[model samples]
Target: MFSFAISKSERNALFHRRETMATRMFLNGGVYSMADSGRLDARVEGLTIDPVDGRVLAVGPQCGPVAASDVLQLPAGAVIVPGLHDRHTHWLFALFANAVVLGGVKTLAEAAARIEAQLAEQATGWVVATGWNTGLLPAGLLTQSWLDSIVKGRKAIIFDQSFHGALISSTLAKEIVSKFPREAIGSYHDGVIHEQYVMLAMAWMELDDWTLKAALLQRQIIMGRVGFTRITDMGVMGFPLLHALQDIYRRGLMILPCDFAVQPWMLREDPLLSATSASVLHFQLRWLKEFADGAFGNRLACMCGHHRYSDGQGGKLLLDERRYVDDVLLARERGIDQFAIHCIGCAACEAASTAFGTVMQRLNGESSGCTFSFEHFETVHPKLIEHVARLQRAHVRIEVCSQPGFLSDLTDYTDRLAAHVMARINPYGDFRKEGLAWRAGTDGAITGDDPWGGMALAVNRGGEQTITVPEIMGTFIDAPLAVNGPATFLILDRDPFAHLEQLGQVQVLETWIEGRMVFHRRN
Candidate 1:
């Protein structure tokens, strides 16, 4: 069912042709051309590509003639679809794929054992680990003593699955408390790190550029293997990371096209913009990232009502209203086209909407070229939805970038917080009814970053607010392939439409970017 038509010699020949040939023809596949209306057009049998420029030159049965050497015939039953895009994801952090992953550990003891093993393997430095859920622990909390027992007073930080906070060893806490300002250290409770502390601790143990570049390349290959051709990095660190990505692109090592949203703090602290024309392959610095609140899983999301497990208290707001408004205005004035604000709770969503309103009113509603997005618009209160609809009616381009996989990830938690939170998490149907422009993201290493898993979650929604396959697919592949468009696409082993329920199980035979085969399944 999953096979490559090109043998080893043929694959080598094709790679050689990629450098020498001006044009290439990909034939014998079900090519789903994207329509202007954002729907898949009828499948074509062939596509002619200009390999040098990485664009689709022609399509349909009557594609112009090409030499036999230029034709790369696909295997039987191959299905070619337009490239996929994740509108919001942390690209740099996703590189932590190599870090000690502990997503499905059942107990704190299990987590400790895993951390102990990783610490044993590493010779020196902090032993960082991630993806431990307190809910899974018997004590229902990650205490410093527990981490200290395993880390043996060594510097370590174990991030929760939500990534809103972490569990730090006492050795790391003492170092932070001594060196950093009390405010910068944020909250350290029972061994858990919160807010600015998480950022500061990560900065302290930041990976070297060489290690980061290697991890980034691994992440890109993983993305291509999962059918992502373009991604919008929701919160990219400025300067060093930006420069590193530029170098990666210049060396022709970058696999996918990336658009970055610089952290708002970086915009203020560094205040430098790289030349966009330096290299077309370079990652584009696009938007400013502003966090309105934290995440729901960690009880840090700024909610209007009480958290079910907590002492009837709402979540925390991370931003000052006046500063948030001023920052948006400043970014717009500085020529940024978009501002992405992370708002997971109703209170945070309302606050961000209000800020957008204030800034738009000040600009006399002249926000045609600029847009604002509420990342993880998770909770849907009637008031928040109504307010967002009103803002949309007022010509404010307020889009939402939601992670449907959160539904699959938070199903049990949602049940526990049922009385306190909205019944439906990520109300895609409600968003559609309200005529809100929205896109889906995986949030990466934080959640499982598989797009097919995301698509499955969007369609099923665990029987709460389901959407049709096409509607869900739109969020993954928003645009259709066209002439002069970036040559990016996925070759699937089975037709997705015919195997809707098994979408996540569908194998990606190959992924092409800019007319070159970036990934191929090793049969």
Candidate 2:
């Protein structure tokens, strides 16, 4: 249902066409467009928007002969900036995942109260929930017996903090094993189902089209509240969720745009893949994602030297080199040009880099117009950088999608490696110098998906590798509010550019997508 242009010529035609009737104009606001550090400049007076295409028709000082009917007069001294983009997040999952969220619950009693509340409300359905931090409930206490005592055999699944896996009650586990015949998912060691295998176990849980619509509505509501006009979801699973998104857009209920990665194995029957389409305005299914290693809390983060959970020789790779390479190359053959690999540990990072290098080599020394990103590149290593540099030399672009909020909320795995070692390993400054592109992501659903908060965390890291506000914002923002750009932007209460310390405190008074106001704070 999305109407985006794929080719450069098509976009050029859209941009070059003469402006149509300016249906709306945002008047009397300080327009602040961000650019690279070198160009921290420029201010505009207003923007005239074309309703038909949802793009800016005119810029500053182009005072209109248009009628006053379309004008939206700004409040005294309102500041209009570009709408925010969360380069990496799970906006869909943030709303649709578990009805009962247990994030930040440090005590078992608190978790029980929430579960019982959900039980009393739903009555008969499964108590599907996520956000069970290993630190919140240590491995020893995270057991079937422990959960059975609380839920009393009611169908319940308390997934990990990241929702990568789940700890199911015996009742639900039995039902899952009976339905899905997979050894990896069936064997619930310590009552924990690992990574992608949990997807197989989740076959028992199903939602109707109406529920998906409601979830989609909630997803947009939160996006507006958080000032995010665009989100890049890590991965989107199943055909129903995809169709639900399309149906929402068809009904004019979609307020923002989303670019998401897909798991081909999950979408094997999808006609969208069969069409081999790259993307439209709202949805992008060209990127394929895979997890090279499990999460750190699970002690399955493949690392070197010492790890508290896995074998001393370091953790293990969820997808070994050969399998990963085969899957990537196969997806590439099917027109998947973008690939996101989950690499939280140095050992996992190394393995992914090597496999990607093989992918490049298979292309006969060319990158083959493919992109590789390391999601949550938490612990970067010099050797990993060297591998990246080699790939870069061959024109293979590598992106690091980092979640700074992890530093604030999740610090349980910090002690596993020395501070100095990690500091020396994750040389972001050097990465920048070598022309490696990086972006800040909130890892939403895992952490709060606020760009301002993400900027604050990066600037306030209080370490040698700490980045400046300009450094982080440069990832998504650009200057001067280009005329042909989509009319997606935000309205803030004050001049966000000047106040560095108050970055975290800045509030989004309004959020607009394609010139239409989607979110207006009612303060």
- The per-prediction tally of clashing pairs is 1, 1
Candidate 1: list runs displaced more than 4 Å.
Answer: 1-17, 20-24, 36-41, 138-141, 177-186, 238-240, 273-280, 294-317, 329-335, 364-366, 386-395, 412-416, 419-422, 462-464
lDDT of 1 by residue, 1-523 (tens): 2221335564343222235465656555678766545555356777777777888877666367777777777777768887788887776674365568777777766787788789888767778787665555532445788778878878888776666577778888888755544433145556666655666566566556677676676677777778887888887654556666777776556747888786556555554553243224647777877765643233435221112233232333355656666666666655677878777777667666776666667668576778888888887686677677777788667787888777676643643455446455787777777666678899877666688887876776655467877777777883577877877777888877667788777778777777877777772
Q: Pick the candidate with the highest TM-score.
A: 1
RMSD of each: 5.5, 6.4
Residues 1-523, model 2: lDDT tens digits: 4342135453222222223465656455677665324764456677666656777767675455656766667776567777777778764573344467777787878888888887887766677777676665665666778788878978878777656567788987777756543423123466766556575644336665566666666677776676787788777655666666766665445646777887646534453462155455576666778776644233434221111334333324555667666767667666677888877767667766776777777778455677888887766776666667665676657877777676665365464446654564345665665666677777776767666776776677675667666676666552235677787777887666667788788788877777666676772
lDDT of each: 0.67, 0.64
Deviation from truth (RMSD, Å), model 2: 6.4
Pick out the ten consecutive residues of candidate 2 with the lowest summed lDDT: 302-311
Candidate 1: clashing pairs of residues: 34-480
